[model samples]
Structures are given as structure tokens and as C-alpha cells.
Target: VALALCVIFNNSPVGSAISLIGMMLCLAGIFVLQQAHFIAILQVLIYAGAIMVLFMFVIMLLNLKQGENEGWASREKNLLLSVLTGFLAIGILYKISQVLFSVNMDTPASLPDSFGTVAVIGETLFTDFVLPFEVA
Candidate 1:
């Protein structure tokens, strides 16, 4: 829904960026519901926070006015772009269907005892990423 709203608010760059951030937050919520706390946090921090700030900064810097190039494209160019977009959409749908049909929908196996635990994560982080962890 938020993604659809982003498209609907395409005329306003700031509004579209806000809706895109909303979509990112929705995805983060989904990750939380799936018991992926670390991924959810990273999603919120990286995408919704940093990337949205950058996007908004760029949008403000551009200072684009509405309908600045409303009549710039000729009818032939519009038709060509429409056809290209259609083909791209068709290709994406085809790829999605292929993946859907190929993958099994079976229930996943249970997680191990130490899987996703704080102790295990901390130990691995300290061991494998000692320099980076210390640097940060």
C-alpha cells in the first residue's frame, strides 16, 4: 500500500520519498515479525534513516518545479517508453513466476539452540570482526 502511494505521489518528489520511507518501515516491521531483529534494525537504520535523508537532501537540492517538463516528450517517445516499460514488467513477472514455481513451499527446519542468540552473535562479532568492531 505504501509502495502504491509512492507511485501515486510521484508528482511531488518529497511526498514520494516519504511514502518510500514508509514502505521501508513496513518491510522492517515484517522482518521483526519474522524474528529477524538485527535485520529489522539495520533496515530501519540504513534505508529508512540514512538513505531517506540522502534522498530528501538530493530532492531539496534539485529544487524541481512541478510540470517543468510536462510537454518535453513527443508522442513517439512516450509510446516507445511505454512499450519498453511493458516489456520490462513482463520480464520481471516472468522471472518471479519462474522462481515461485521452482522453489518449494515446505515448512523450514527448526533453528539450532545457539542460533540468533546474543552470546553467539557477540562471540562471532568479536572473533571474526575484531578490527572493524574495535574501529567502530
Candidate 2:
């Protein structure tokens, strides 16, 4: 919802950036509630802190100003983009509907005692995702 509002306020660059940060923070909170503390910390530190600061810096550095009555594009281009977006949205909805109708709501399998433990997660991270994890 906050992200949708941010997109709606595209004319205000600083406001949009601020709202984007708010949305990231909200996601971090959700992660915390899901017991993914490391992911939550990463979300706040990497997304809300570092990336947003860069975005704000660029916005300020560019000194963007919106002109009165200015459109994002000419009418023809806007119409083309709207048509494309509508088609994309329809495709996504169709895929979602298919999944919803076809899903089998079976009883979930039981998890092992070590499932979601820090040590287990750490082992998988170091073993399977070493390069990408180290790069991050």
C-alpha cells in the first residue's frame, strides 16, 4: 500500500524516496516478526539506509523540478505504455488465478527440529551460497 502511494506521487521525487524508505522499513518489521532477524537487519541497513541515502543524494544533486502541466510523455506514448501495462497486469492476474484454482491444500509436512535454526541456516549459507553471500 505504501509502495503504491509512493508510485502515485512520482512527481515528488523526495517524497517518493521517503515513502520508499518507509516501505522498506515496514518490510523489515515484517521480517522481524517472521523471526528472520538477519534478513530484517540487512533490509534496514542495505535498503532503507544505504540505497535510500544514495537515491536522496542523486535527487538533490540533480536538483529536479517538475514543470506545471507537464506530462511524463506525449499522449501517444502514454497510451502505448498504458496498453502494455494493462496487458501485463492481465497476464499476471491470469497466472495467479490458475495457481489459485489448481492448488492442492494438503496437510503440510512436518519439519525437523533443526529446521530454521541459526546453525543450520549458517551452514547452508556458508556451503551452498558462499560466493553470493560473501559478495553481499
Candidate 3:
């Protein structure tokens, strides 16, 4: 429901920019909640702070107006496709959840202070996934 409101606001130019900023912050909060502090901070600094600011400035400079929204009513074929996609997504998620929760993994009693910190994440990324990081 909150997301729908955000999207509705996003139909307006200024509200759209604010909505984008809010989305970036929300995503950062999710990252933090998932124990990915390094990613969360980077998401805020890079996406929410720098990129979104640049986007807002460009939109303001352009003085963009809201365009008419297209495709409010769905066709029968489109509705069928949507239902198929939804079921496929649900099936995939169910399979993944089963795999993930099938094993009873032991929980760690405590994490080091450095866990999910920027420095530690950087070290791990460079050491363990240097090639993929560079390619990306």
C-alpha cells in the first residue's frame, strides 16, 4: 500500500523525485536490516545522496512535466501473462526457500565488530571475487 502511494506520487515531477529518494533510502534500510551495513552505507552515499541529487537537479533543470499514464486497463492476454508470471515467481521462491531452510544450520553466538564493516567487505570482495568485481 505504501509502495502504491509512492508510485502515485511519482506521477508528479517533484513528487517523483522525492519518491525516488525515498525508495533509495528504503532500500538502504533494507540492506542494513539484512546485516549488510557496508552495502547500506554505500547505497545511501552513492545512490541516494549522489546519484539521486544529480537526477533531481537534471529533472528540475529540464522542468519536466508529468506525462499521461498509459495502459490502465489490462487486456485478457496481458492478465493471463501476469497470472502466469506470478505463479512462476511463487514457485521459484518456494523452491528456493525449501532449499535454504531444509538444513538446520548452526547459529553463530556472536559476530566480530568488523563483520559487515566497509573495510572487511572491501577486503573480502577484492580477495574472493576480484575478477567478478572488476568485470562488473
Candidate 4:
């Protein structure tokens, strides 16, 4: 959805911003699915909130106008792209089908019960991730 918005509405800053927000939410959903609730919340709060606000501020301050968003290719080129995309989609579906036949999908045995807790994230943030966090 986000990519479609970006591609189809290249002339609109609002469209790009909305796409960015959608991407952030999708990332947050992936984090939640991975049991990283703290990271998911932070993703929405920091990247979606603060960074998006900054981007909008920059866009507003620059007073940028919409640019040309015309397609560069002819109908034949578009048809070729459509065919390639169809093949890619079929390949992706095939990979997903293979997952159903797989037998090994369990979590690693070394992962602790506290792996996804706020405390664990906090500890790691203040320790191993401290330098990068500070730099940021």
C-alpha cells in the first residue's frame, strides 16, 4: 500500500507522508508479530511520531512544489513490467506454500522467557546498544 502510494502519487507530499506513516505501521506490526512489543511501540512513537513530524516540518519549511510524475515507459514496457511483477508474485506465493510443508518453525531453545519484556529491552538498550543510541 505504501509503495503504491509512493509510486502512484509522486507529485504529492501528503501522499509521501501518508506512505511513510503506513510503512511505519507495517514495521510496527512486524515487530509485534516477533514479540518485540517495546520495539513496536517505540517504532510507532519515535519514527512515526517524531521523525514524521520533522519530515513534514522540513517539507513545509522548504515550500516545495509537486514535480512531474509521468511514466517514462511506453505501453509495451508497462506490459513487460506487469508480466515480471506477475511472475514475482507467483514466486512469492510458491515460497509461502513451501513454508506449510516445513516441519521446523519453533523458537530457539536458548531464547529466554523474558526475551520480549520491557526490562530486557531496556537493559540491552542501556548496554549493548548504548553507543548507537547515544549517537542517535
Number of the predicted model whose lDDT against the real structure is largest? 2
lDDT of 1 by residue, 1-65 (tens): 53744445356888888888889999999988877777789899999999999999999999977
| Deviation from truth (RMSD, Å), model 1 | 5.6
lDDT of each: 0.80, 0.81, 0.77, 0.78
Model number with the top TM-score: 4
**Predicted candidate 4 versus true structure: per-residue lDDT over 1-136, tens digit per residue:** 4355354545567668768877888989999988899999999999989998899888888888865656554565567667767887898899998986774667554767898998887898899999998998
* Rank by lDDT (best first): 2, 1, 4, 3
Worst 10 residues of 2 by lDDT: 1-10
- The local distance difference test score of model 1 is 0.80
If the candidates were sorted by their TM-score against the true structure, best first, what order would they fall in? 4, 3, 2, 1
Between 1 and 3, whose TM-score is larger? 3
Candidate with better TM-score, 2 vs 3: 3
Q: Which tens-of-lDDT digit does each residue in 37-107 have in candidate 2?
A: 77788899999999999999999999999778565555765676567678878999999999878987585
The TM-scores, one per candidate, come to: 0.52, 0.58, 0.60, 0.72
Residue pairs in candidate 4 whose N, alpha carbon or C atoms collide under 3 angstroms? none
Model 1 — which ten-residue stretch has the worst lDDT?
A: 1-10
State candidate 1's TM-score: 0.52
